[model samples]
Target chain A: MLRIEHFTKTYRSKVAVDDLTLHIAPGEICGFIGHNGAGKTTTLKACCGILQFDKGAITVNGHSILTDPIACKRDLAYIPDNPDLYEFLTGIQYLNFVADIYEVSKTDRNQRIAHYGNLLGMTEDLTLKISECSHGMKQKIALIAALIHKPRLILMDEPFVGLDPIASHQLKNVMAQHCAEGGAILFSTHVLEVAEKLCHKIAIIKGGKLVASGTMEDVRGQASLEQVFLDLEDTL
Target chain B: MIRTLVSLRFRALFTGLIVQRQKKNKSSKGTVILFAFLFLYVFAVVAGMMGFTFYSLAQPYHMLGLDWLYFSMAGLMGLGFAVLGSVFTTQNQLYDAKDNPLLLSMPIPPRIILLSRMIPLLAMNLLFGGLVIVPATVVYAIFVEFSIVGLLLQLLCLAGIAVLAQAISCLLGWLLHLLLSKLNKSLASVLYLVVFLGIYFYVYSQAGEILTAIVMESQQIASILSKWVWPLYAMGMGCLENGGLLLAFLGICAVCFAAVYAILSATFLRSATMSSVSRKRQKLNLKTSKTAPPVNAIVGKELRKFLGSPVYLTNLGVGLLMAAALTVAGVIFREDLLSAFSMIPGFTDLIPLLICAVLSFLISTMYISAPSVSLEGKNIWILKSLPVSGKDILNAKLLFHCRMTVPLCGICGFVLALAYG
Candidate 1:
């Protein structure tokens, strides 16, 4: 579970996220929807201990990201929108490095790497340098690295951007499985249909303010996710 | 188009040097002032050293009627300093620059783009050139009167010599890029360190002997050197006796510069964009890997980073390589080295201690953390999101430095002490 209360972040005098409060329960997949510069990325980054907020607290599994960031981070994994892996390292080497950071055992890492490598069709290319990978391949490697740690919370920013259809389907299944195992996911996406289908809870943000947030059905009511998002944006 | 490219290049280099750091640390007034003072101090010391050397040479040179030797030495020193100062810049700006695609994709002519890059490099060479030529010329002008034509020739030769230096450095950079493409990355870094240190230490250790020799036997040395260095001979003649020699010297420099520019226009795009390494897929073997704590993993990652890039490796690990080289020299030349030190009172017994101190200072200066942190650039999110504290990440970088420095320094210190004993 992740909770952020009264979070405020600013770049100079310009607020990127203003007085934001959010929570994700265990066994829930929360889709954060926002237009460009709407603070979704900022909020996600702060929750993952990547950014320091001006005011408020963020907790990952009851550990404060600001005060006990290491403990908080250990229970969570974050995949950024651009997966800039160490270009010099091979794909397997990068995964191994990540696994090592989380202190995964040899047997566990091997099993997960094999399972994910085959699932993502990256088994043949694990020895290639990350610099040699295409965008989709890099995304797949990043996803695999994020999963290798087996964190209680997973946060992703635009996680579907470079994925192919089969990989996207695979990712959806993985997210479902992770949620079923009581892990929470908070992801930002531009695709409303995917969020509508995949997310148990949805939040819409505009101009650094949350416009609506709740269970997907409660927020959308009779309207399609896209229609509701458009209406909310117009009101914003 | 040339102006735009030049501005872009200037912005890129200076933005890192000035703007970004200041913007991030806007509250630090003391830091800014300290940096300013430090920069000024270094500049003053360098200028003072050059002034003293030129002034000391002026009277003797005038008395010996070896103005040609003086001119030649000045020109050659200027060229040498410029080239030495610019090799790394050439490597970065010409071959492996990150902005190649962004600039190349524009509709600007390729030759214009080449000129844009070359201009800043030329400016840097000229700056270094000025440090030598300006003080030397000023000393000559003040100590010895010259005719109007002589002064004009001298001025023209100075400008021509700077162009010559820039052209030669560019060609050397081109050759380096070619060599880098063919060599193994690790071996290339080792080779660069050895070559650079060899040249540096040789000149540093032998400078006093060379200066004494030049002072005692200027005429014979000048005559012999003049034969091998004709443009310098021409520059001297143009400044003292014959104006036509100055024109000839200028013509030679012009020809060389034009040739370099022509080659750059013709092939620079291909050369600059050429990838230094070729990628080949290795056979995949899925094997279980033992895990370490996060700090160990990060240190291992940092080590791989250091080893992966020849440029980065040489830049950061140069002191370690130098220490090793010094240790071997200490062993092989123990007798000769001590004998040389024996001439100075009370210095012979402290030679080992001195060597250790100097080596320690060099080792301490080789901090990779500051630059490595900046090197993360846009990819910093990886570290930020990792299940590690800020202190752990910093410690990882520090661990890398310790691992590289400690053992090497200890061995060198031991070798020095053992040789002395």
Candidate 2:
């Protein structure tokens, strides 16, 4: 489970993310939606312990992101919008480094790497330096590296931007599977259709404030997710 | 549109410098005062050089006047050129590339982008050149009683020489890059080190001749160079005697500048467009094996990362190679060093161990394994998203640093002990 309360982030005189509160239960997929500069990324980063928030609390599995970041991070995985891995390392080498850090046993690491490598169609690219990989390839490697450790909670910011349709379908399946197996996912995306189709719960933010949060039916009140989004945006 | 773009870029560059200074908690007021002091120091250096030249010229056949002038000019020009090249090649690349992805993706033209970058390069070179050349020429003028025309001609000539030197250095660096890229990446790095060392040694050897001439016969030094050196002579004589050579020198500089600019611009564009290609791997026939030990895994990962990038590997990891070369050279060239050490009653046995420890520390810190986490650029998020604890990640990075440095340190220690014992 993940919880955030009264979170605020300010840069100079501007509030990038105002007081916000939300929660996600285990085995739930929450789609976070907002326009450009709506603070989706900021909130995700804050939750992941990447960026510090001015006032509020965020906890991953009862561990505070700030007070116990290492423990919190140990239970969570975060993938940023752009997947910039060490360009010098081959995909496999990078994975191995991640495995070493997570202390994943040799047997587990090999099994997981092989499973994910095959799923992502990255088995062939594992030997090649990341510098030689294309944008999508880098993203896949990043995704594989993130999931290899199998944390309780996963936080992804703009995770689907560079993925092709086939890759996207596979990722959606994996996300759903993860949720089914009792892990929660919090992802930010502009694609309302994907949010409608995949998210078990959805949260909408406008001007850094949480405008709506609940099950799609609860927030929409008989309207489609798109209509609900447009209506809320119109009211704003 | 171009003008707007250029001005915006220029403003951004200055703004960035200011922002960085602010971030570091440095006052803009302090920077201005520092620059003012630098200018004053430069002026004093130039005045002293000129006075020295005049004193030397006044004593004898006035033949030394030209020699002094040439020596000062070359020294000033060389120093200016070196500062410009170093700032442009290393400092600019290191800082600018930190935020280059954002800038590169913007709508600015490539040439304009290059020009905006070159502004700082030009400013630094011009500042250094003025400090050196102005004083040397002023003193020469006072001693020689140069007419206004002569002074103007000399100024023009110095300008050309400075530009020519800067252009040549930049061109040579570009050409070297192109040549190096044709070879295997690893071999190219080694070749670069060899070339760099070769040039440094050659330049060091010529230092004595240059300095002695400057101190002994300032005017004669200038005059000899003016007479024997085609461009400098043309420039100095034209200044001293109102001749046409100043225009000729300017013309040569202009042509050379244009050619060098064209070559560099083309090369820069090509490099920006070309994707880096990696070596293809052959399939391994070996069976799957168990994972290596924790330390070995960490060390292997770090070594792979270090070796994968030619630039980082050569610059950072080559400390061992450098230490080896230095040790061998010291043994070959300075047998007295070892003998002198042996005379220190209790210190003889400790020297090798001390050397090893120092080298290990230097190597470990210099390569910086922990900072590599931040250097991941965009990929840091992936690492952050893993289920690994921050301590584990930090430990892995630190382990890599120790792994590289400790063994090399041990080897060096062992070798030195064997030799001394």
Candidate 3:
């Protein structure tokens, strides 16, 4: 389970994120939605221990992100909105480097790399330099790399932005499979349709505060998710 | 439009420099100290020039005699300015641009972009040139007993010469880049090294001539330079005792400035356009291993990353090649270097140790084995979110660095030991 308690982040005079509390249990796919500068990236960065938050306690499987960042990080994989990998490295080389860090056994890494690489249609490109890959290709490479070590929790921000529809569909399936296997996912996106169809639960943020959060049925009551989202946004 | 672009460029350069300084943990105190030292050095050099000018002016016979001294001073200043400009423009500009995505996406003309970038190059060169020229000219005025008109002319000439030198260096750099773009990796490295060495050799040879002229035909130096008809004419005529020559030199400077500007504008646009057109996308098919080797899988990934970019590979891999080339050349030319080494009393005995130390330091510093974490740019989150400890991630990067450094250092050490023995 992943838990974020009373998380708050301030940038000078403006509060980017207010005291926000949330939790994700195994097998849950939580889609995070927010407008530009609504603090989705900041929240995700804080959860991944990439950006330090002024006031918050984030823990993964009872390990504190602040106190035991290394342990906390061990349970999570994060993909940023614009996936900037080392352009100098080939796809395979980057994967191998990640595997070495995770201490994935050679047998497991090879098998998993093959499976994920094939799934993402990146098997041949693994040998080519990443600088040579297109934006979508790079995105796929990043996805496979994140999945290489099989962390319990995955945090992604705008993962589908540059992806083709086919790649996006494949990724959605992968996310579903990951959840079915008892892994949890928390991702932020502006694509309403994706959030509506793919998410088990949805969290909406406006002006650095969570306006609503819960399973689709729980949050919307009788109204559609889009209607609820628009009504909440209009109120803000 | 030009002025605005220049101002924007200057701000960008300053901001980029500040960002770099911040990353290196430099404080205001260090900058203050550096400027203080520079001020003292400039003051002393300028004071000496004033003393020389006064001495020459007091003796009419020495009026023309001091010209060679001025010529050598100008050449030395121009050379220094050229080198500093080249190093700054070539080494840091591209690296600085890497982090600035917004600048790359700007709608401004690419030539405008390139020229704006080059503004800092010109500005830095002018600053250094001024430090060299102002002091020397001030001293010349005091010694030569020249009128106010003569003094102003000499100053104008100095400015013209600095501008000309800056233009030449910029042109050379662009031409070199155009040529290098067509070469493969290994050849490109060799070509670059050769060009650098060639320039160094040319400068060294010229320095000897300049020194000899200062001792021999001092006054004739300015006269000879002035007679050359273009930039040198302006500088020479400005300092000449004749008022007519000073006006002519100023006119020449105006023409030269116009020509340089026209050439720069034309070349910059072409270069920028070429760069944009040359960027091609590749089709890749990334394959995964059926059975991953424990460390190899990860190491393979790192190898690909290192070898993927020309810039990264050249910066890191070229060090090993450089060490190897130097070692082989040392062995081949052992007699030449050893003979020179033998002349230096203490250096002979310490050559082996010196070689080992130098080679080890060079390999370690030049090849960035583990800058991988920082190099990851935005993808750091992906690595962070992995089911791995920070230590493990850091260790992987450290291991990558070690993988390259250890073997190269060991090889160089062995070769040095064998050669010395």
Candidate 4:
């Protein structure tokens, strides 16, 4: 479970996120939708213990992200939109490095890396340097690294941008499987169709404010996700 | 078009300085002022040394009836230093500049881009050349019986030499970039280390003999400069006595600069357009083992980064490498070194302390942490999102520094103690 209360983040004179409150229960896939500079990335980053909010409390599995960041981060993983990884390291080496960071057991790391590497058809390229990888391949490696520890909560920012249709479908399955196994996911995406189909709940943000949030049915209600999103942007 | 690119490069170089100036806080503003004063002090000291060198040489060369030789030697030495300093900066500006892609994508021609990039490097050489040559010129004007035309030619030669130095350095920089590109990344650092060691050995081996000959038989130095080093002779003749030689030297400078610019624009544009990273795929072998703790892993990554970058290692790690090399030399030649020190007046008692002090100074100067954070740039978020304390991340950098430096220092300290005993 993840909870954010009255989250506010300011950059000098500009307020990036303001008075935002959000929560996600176990076994739920919460899709966060917002336009560019709408503070979706900021809020996601704040929850993942990467960004600090000016006035708010964010807790991951009852551990406050601000006060107990390591503990909060232990149960959550974040993959940024453009995953600029260590270009010097080979794909396998980078994955193993991240595994070590999260303290994954040897047996678990081996199994998880093999499974994901094969699933993404990246096993053959595991020895290739990250700098040599295509955009999609790099995205797959980052996704695998994020999932290596099997955190209870996953926060991804535009996780679908570089992914191909096949990889995107595989990722959708993985998200569903992760949620079904009692994990929660809060992902920001511009793809409303993917969110409409895969998300158990949805949150719409406008200018750093949460304009609408509820179960997918309630948020859209007789309107398509795109129609509902456009309506929210127009009014809010 | 060239002006825009030069301004962009200038802005990039002074971004931090500009930011400090924009700050509202008094302390930040004070730092900018402090840096300015520090820069001026360094410039003044360098110029002062140049002036002193010319003043010392003026009387000897005047007596030898070779005032031109003195000017030539001073200009050559000044240009030599400028070339040495400009090589690294030229390499950074032309080959490794992060803005290359953005600049290349624009509608400007490649030669204009090359010229624009070289301008800043040339400006730096000019600063260094002026510092050295201006002082020498003033001294020559005061002491030497130079004609008005001679004095004017001398000043022109000084500026001309700076441009020539920049041209040579840029050529060398372009060559290094090309050579390093063809070699494996791991080998580049090792190759640089070997080259550095080789240069050090050559300088140290030759310095005593060269200095002894120059001090005991100064005329021999002038003969060598005038006969073998034709450009130096031409420059001095042009500057102090002859106007025709000055025009010839200026003509050479212009030709060299144009030739280099043309060559870089033609040959390097293709190489520059391509990505810097090697495209060879690494062989895959997945072997599972128990991973290191987070801090250890971080330290390992940091070490890889430090070792992987030839520029970072060659420039910043030089001190650490020197300490190790010196420590080895101390152990190997302890008896000879001790006897040599004992020969000096009141030196035997302070040998151990002197060794320790030198080692400490070398270790203190290797601050890898200073630029390590900025090097991360876009990838810093990966660290921030990891399941580790901020303290651990900082400690990882600190520990990496300690790991590289402490063991060698400890060994040297032990060896010096044993030698003293």
Which has the greatest lDDT?
1
lDDT of each: 0.85, 0.70, 0.69, 0.84
Give Cα distance to truth, residue A114, candidate 1, Å.
2.0
Write down the worst ten-residue block by lDDT for model 2 chain A: A96-105
B47-86: candidate 1 lDDT, tens digit per residue: 6777777777777888998887887888888889899889
* TM-score head-to-head 2 vs 4, winner: 4
Candidate 4 local lDDT, residue A74: 88
RMSD of 3: 5.7
For the second chain, the TM-scores of the candidates in order are: 0.86, 0.66, 0.67, 0.86
Q: Which lDDT tens digits does candidate 2 get at residues B288-390?
A: 5345644556567667767666666666756766666656765574567677877899777687676767666656646657457755555556555554456
**Model 1: runs farther than 4 Å from truth?**
A132-134, A164-166, B21-37, B146-149, B184-190, B215-228, B309-312, B340-363, B366-379, B391-398
Per-residue lDDT for A3 in model 1? 92
* All candidates: CA RMSD (Å): 3.1, 5.5, 5.7, 3.1
Task: For each candidate, give its TM-score against the true structure.
Answer: 0.90, 0.78, 0.76, 0.91
Highest DockQ: which candidate? 1
Q: After superposition, how far is residue B64 of candidate 4 from its true place, in Å?
A: 0.7
CAPRI grade, predicted model 1: medium
Query: Which should have the higher TM-score, number 1 or number 3?
Result: 1
Please give the distance, in angstroms, between residue A56's alpha carbon in candidate 3 and its true position after superposition.
5.3
Instruction: Look at candidate 1 and tell me the lDDT of residue A21.
Output: 90
Question: What CAPRI grade goes to candidate 2?
Answer: acceptable
Candidate 3 per-residue C-alpha lDDT over A1-236 given as tens digits, one digit per residue, 9 for 90 to 100: 78989999998789999998889999999999888999999999999888888998999989988888878776788888887777666677677767766777778777887787777777777776676687888888888878878988999999998988878989999999999999999999988888888889899988899989989779878887778888998988
CAPRI quality of model 4: medium
